[model samples]
Target chain A: MSEPLESTLKPGDSYVQSFARGLSVIRAFSAEAPRQTLTEVAKRCGLTRAGARRILLTLETLGYVKADGRLFALTPKILDLGFAYLSSQPLWQFAEPVMQQLAGELKESCSAAVLEGGDIVYVLRVPARKIMSINLGVGSRLPAWCTSMGRVLLAGLPPAELEEQLARVQFHSHTARTARNLDELRTRIAQVRSQGWCLINQELEEGLVSLAAPIVDRNGQTIAALNVGAQVNRTPPEALLEQCLPRLLEAAQSISRLLQIKS
Target chain B: MSEPLESTLKPGDSYVQSFARGLSVIRAFSAEAPRQTLTEVAKRCGLTRAGARRILLTLETLGYVKADGRLFALTPKILDLGFAYLSSQPLWQFAEPVMQQLAGELKESCSAAVLEGGDIVYVLRVPARKIMSINLGVGSRLPAWCTSMGRVLLAGLPPAELEEQLARVQFHSHTARTARNLDELRTRIAQVRSQGWCLINQELEEGLVSLAAPIVDRNGQTIAALNVGAQVNRTPPEALLEQCLPRLLEAAQSISRLLQIKS
Candidate 1:
């Protein structure tokens, strides 16, 4: 598990420690440890057994977690917490039809994600096909330094914040084509910023080729990124750029226009 | 907003009051009130301004909620909380491909939902076309008493629990075809339980016809529901039952088998 970001926060009158810990407990249950015993949950979340027990029971009482004998797991009611975010932002709803159209036209999976810390969290996704070995859904997170959507979102960030985020990344090469160093990544982000779009070729995965464009607000600030992914063998970079990029840009622009009206 | 469920629970040693309150604050933001001021949030969540402010600040610190001047709104990071649920339950992941294929075969919108409180929360949705006036997506909630997926999920519950859930619903007739009273709804639910599938003809919305089957575990427990929806104009009730029912049942059974293997 990644380090608990909450641990860094100094609890004050404004910071609810118990609330933060509850979130930590929720985050502790991941793909690796979906179902865990009390001790396991405590250890993973960096909490005492007593604290974890209280939080777990609280979750159970609220119908967010279910206890199956000795093990505990999150229930579907927990989706309401995520739905709270999706329903609040009408931007995602507006982006969906446009994305669906783009995915149909291009015959590729289309997604929209926003920069969250050092990652991009997919808020909306319309899949034309399963293009990746790793299955990604609405809430899926990918490293911001390696993904097409990531770079587009990163390009939207101010230089100082972008640098800070880059410094925190424990960069490991996913493939030979992935940006190797801080300078290369910065250059790529700079290119995305200049060109107003990004195309990642076999960086995150060997056969994955994706192109991304920014979904901006009224002020032209990029709030989210829109991307389309295909296989390298199926569509070479030339074909992707020539055939798909225009439609991708148009869809992103259309979403941006909708967002502007909504805002 | 519905009555806060946490208010009914007594504050015991195991119950985290601050955590529950924090969740209430999060839930306070919805489709009706996407962004709110401190006073508005406190009023909606039944918290004191100071209490709401602290929780909101804490949420902002965690990157789940963002502050725009005086207004607070949930950020995309909040989806991570929902993602936690989706990532933990491998059922939704396993069910997605099956849903996609079923949607493709039927040329209709396919969905999987689980019973949560008095509602069914959509976990997986694969849309072949925009069939409904309401755009349903993952985390979207619908009344269990009305939706076909809800009826399938409700039928899966033990009789006493099902009765309790039905009693809690604020029953209202959504359409002329909707069951008018408790007895009528009970009869429909009983039929669904006996037949092992459900077909709702324009009960939830006008011109919407939906058929649903339960996705069961190894023990024959309905863990989730799989549904396919189309317009009444495009496909009559007979066609939905004759043509779509077999595919829907096959898909649901296939998912059940996959769940059995995983468990």
Candidate 2:
């Protein structure tokens, strides 16, 4: 759940309170609550009924949201906002074909993500088959501490920044193999940094195994992480490392080269 | 280009000016200008530098926009806004596998889109291979008058709504094959409405042919359109109709059935 509008921030001169409230209203509508009444939106966003009403009306006027009698839902135009980010960043376009090839070669799912705050946000995903209970796609987020892509992305950050991000992580043990503490995570990320790839065995979810490599920019800075994931029953961790790791690294490097040429 | 912020709307009690301006600022950054200085953002958004600055700063503070020295660019967090729409609308989730199967079977790209204004915005896409010069993905927009999916979506609207949308379209002859005027488009849309499907022969772009069918809700009201597109040289219009049409209609009907069952 997003922090309620009231306690999250005090309206400052530079801050647009109405804009913040509008975003809060948008965020309040999730998969769990796809449709909401005015009162539901108001309560969830921590806005006065009138404030939520105005924001919702404004969104309706903009064609981003529509009302079905008493309930409001986002329209497809809401996608243009996200496409702006994807279209602007050329990296994903460069990564997609490479990731698709990797997925095809390995007969698994491949994904690329960039580190954002304490999480990794998927930017590109090419699935050979569905391997996880969670349906992840572009824009889906996962905890950086447990996900293979997340760890590779974290490994790219400067030590001080990495430590800062790690400190902020509200670690949850998703599986028995998840790193137990900050120190353990730090050690894992260090291993990734030195090895140029990271493999996680059922840390994010049971029966899931994934290997990830960094896609670096012209300056050798890791801009994104590429990953391939499979079910453990179908492909054991050792098999994954032996069969997929080399190809995953090659794909990542190919994308990195493209980024360098473009940049 | 979006209308300049100043003349677009009068700020009423229900209209959130800051929120509108924020959206304008976000739209100002596109493929042409992915990164811009504060002055450029202000000029493009038709806002004073201070107004643009505040929004940019607030966006940066919110982690949606990042500053690279003097330039401001959107970060991947902006995708969360788009993902909210995708995640909430169960339609796309239901459409993906069906569209993928259609694309695989037809050996062509299959897509599903919803009509937003005079454009069809892609909601789900499964590409067999890259065929179009323009790289299209989810959230990409194509003019309704020239696209098979767009015509089917337009056919869904009430007569008055369709006319109103048609009047707003800045008709461009993308190719000689595109519908010449409002009357021609109206006839085409009417044909789609009665025939239950639409096929465009290189109307949007030369050598591109596509066939589209409607995805309807429980009420048999068209909610979206699904399409299969291929190069004209590879798949002639007659082949598309005779060979691909039955399968396209079947795939679309399958999705509509799923929607009815779920709804």
Candidate 3:
């Protein structure tokens, strides 16, 4: 498979089927269907009513999901699962104030993310303005090959890992500026590595421009990336690079320094 | 039995054993042990090495965990579990920008949370300052009967549910200021219910002053509580109420309106 590892998880062998199914049940709910009937959830998760019922009832009993005897919706308790991942990561707590200050000062949304598999997951986010059609928040994933933060993070990876990841990537043109091939994508990552930062214009989404820098540790390994996202109309690639890149790189360096001091 | 319902989910009959075990493995990694050896993980998760290894391998296959044959750690893909909960709830998206603006204007941290069982879980946060000793972020839980936001949410609960929750609450004096008895807590909740807002001066933690207002649905149901957290040294009780209460209430009402619009 040319896709990420998430797709390769076997249905029954080596994995816990019930656990995977339970997660599928949770993921079945979205903005369109926050509350669903047992049959609805059953059909979506590809489980029998009895199987779905047990999983739903388990989640409800645990307080992660709620049921009014018929329909089910997630409870706020589910946030704890996400919180566990976040609180375990030491960088976010230290990086939050820095990201917030940068977002505040620059009047742009700032974030930090880590490359995982073939995607970048937002660990920290501070908003100055709403800029995306899709709502992006902490835990939100974006394709690593397209985003500025993704490029910066990819640039940090060892050559062998990077090649393996590139081999698995299924390239698709999200916008006109999206890299159409692995060679082009590698070139972009190379540029980000050489420059110590990256500025991309309308690559991930139309009207979206972003600048990113790697958050390196004392060992000079990039553990994460800091980025500022803006609208293309108000700030072109050159303007984004000139104005936001320095600040983003500075914040990333400061975060690295904080990590160093704490370690 | 005295603990919250979240503690009651067990494997074997009603719940999926593998799913529960998988989540337990995830919960095992915290600030104390973000990275652990397989033996360490198995011991912490109360699993045999073979069992823990299977779950860890399954998680790695599914992109949630990563291993280097000796040590294991969660990747950012784990955030998807939490993000699914968030994106399903429309109130958060509407509440975030408003919370951010209020935090910016008042120069205090603004957050929104909902009561689940005997705990309050944060769903949204806009930090202008860091005032608490323990780091609190989205999905972080605090005792529901102690904090200003918790009291406001408790005040919103039905009488029967409130009593049931109170019965399970392990009330303790975290500081000299925490609620010592249910009677005093009921009085505080009643006051919050009567006045439509609450302000606590160092109740949850020393030097932490917070004001809270309830976000009601169209049917006048208290769905969530919004709060502004400040430090007692910089802002006195009266000063916090005078400067922050109005904006806090305004923001809560605005969030309620947004929920009504979306619903």
Candidate 4:
């Protein structure tokens, strides 16, 4: 009863808890913790040393993880998992050209992200310039509540689900303009929902400004959020909305059509 | 003894075989077949229908695999595994700026790839132009023996290992200039190893010309191969070597230094 739903697997359920634990072990190694000893992996994954060691060895045997006789890190083959998703997504094949054209027209970096927990994971990106301090690749993540993509994604959820998600967020203010609590965040999300888009000014970072629009399916359900980020001085929030919003909305609409067609 | 090494679990072994099979099932779904029925998945993975059903259901429960109540496909959450690897790679973070600069200087698409099985998986890329008909992303793989990056990676391997790998290659005539046999491939790879770079003209595709150099470590091991790909019309092979090879080699050396420093 006390355990998190994330780790619970029923015994008679025909599911392997160890399998899930192995994936959790893989997830434990992040950008911040690129390499770790057995002890650290165990602690981070809430597993015994024996359990973590076994999974690490198995991954090493399969050429997915490499251990330099002591420390364990993921091998390049692990990128195959991300590749499977990118290749399978009819959405990306449809969205890439559209996003490329938008980025070309606006002369800005555009991306497509989905809300996963309290973060937005970039599923597709077309870069015009490297403006942000962070190195954003396809699999990069940013805080969901603060980023324009995050807000647009959150705005898509049902009220109770959104509240439940918001309840889980442990917000530490990133900037002076960052949302302080649930009330402020809820207000921001509501505005995004009403306007069918979102814009953030110096919230994710000092000089970064972004505008995002919702990619909705045939039923008007949001599957993902599309965004274009630019430096504050080069393109203000109002200018972003005035100039890029129409193209962004148009791109999102085409993606939605493609997804529906695939369905 | 009859059991395949891939699926065989040792008695009292701590490694979870089910976890590996679960990933194999996920991998079985690809760009060609994004969704599969339980029977199809079992056939592809060499598992019983009941066994495949169990694993698919487990993934569905964990929110990694989404089912349409009939067919199974991966959800966005499947991306986390890829994100884990991309985030952990200090190499890509270091290589991006280097690749970006090289791409800018040469006006070509620069990439980094590693040898995995008989393929070269792209680990990082910066495109100056869309020269290929196929979409090249962070995880896209091309035949190792045919690509400049692939030859460089194969050249990095030990003599015996390289021979073993080349023996396994099912060499298809990809182009007019494609390597005819293992002896030819070995000769090409040998030259690449001695010269510290490779240039391939119209081997992988029509009009696709590329040059590659090895990104070595402190131990003088080639961890990855860096390359620049241009069109035949815009940049002839000799001109490519004359203009871009120096910068490409310089980029590879700097990336090697960064890896050594990180270690």
Spell out the clash pairs found in candidate 4.
none
lDDT of 1 by residue, B1-263 (tens): 13333344456643457777888888888888999988899899888866677777788877788878778899888888889888888887788888877887788888999888899999888888444434888988899998899999999998899979988878788889999889999999999999999999999889999999999988888889999888899899999999999999999999999889986
Best-fitting candidate, scored by lDDT: 1
Positional deviation of residue B18's Cα in model 4 after best superposition, in angstroms: 1.9
The alpha-carbon lDDT assigned to residue A187 of candidate 1 equals: 95
| Candidate 3 TM-score for chain A | 0.90
Q: What is the lDDT of candidate 1?
A: 0.85
Question: What digit string (tens of lDDT, one per residue) describes model 4 on residues B1-263?
Answer: 13233344352453446767888887887888788888888999999876787787778777778877567888777888888987887888888877867875777888899888899999887767344423688888888999998999888998798878888999888899999888888899899989999999998889889999999989898889999888888889999999998999999999999989986
Q: List per-model TM-scores for chain B.
A: 0.91, 0.92, 0.91, 0.89
Instruction: Give the Cα error of residue B138 in candidate 3, in Å.
Output: 0.5
DockQ of each: 0.47, 0.45, 0.47, 0.44
Global fold similarity of model 2 (TM-score): 0.93
Give chain A TM for each model in order: 0.91, 0.93, 0.90, 0.87
Q: Write the per-residue lDDT of candidate 1 for residues A1-263, one digit (tens) a residue.
A: 13332344455643456777888888888788899988899999888877787788789877788888778999888888888888888898888888878887888888999888889999888888444324788888999999999999999988888889988977789999999998999899999999999999999999899999999998878899999988889889889999999999999999999889877
TM-scores, each model vs. reference:
0.93, 0.93, 0.91, 0.90
Residue-wise C-alpha lDDT for candidate 3, range B1-263, written one tens digit per residue: 13233344454543456677788888887878888887898999899977787778787767678876577888888888888889889999889878877987888888889888788898888777433433588898898889888989888888998889888878888789877898888888899999999998787888888999999999998989999888788888999999999889899999999899988
- Candidate 4 stretches greater than 4 Å from native: A1-15, A130-134, A258-263, B1-16, B129-134
Higher-ranked by DockQ: 2 or 4: 2
Residue A82, candidate 2: alpha-carbon lDDT = 90
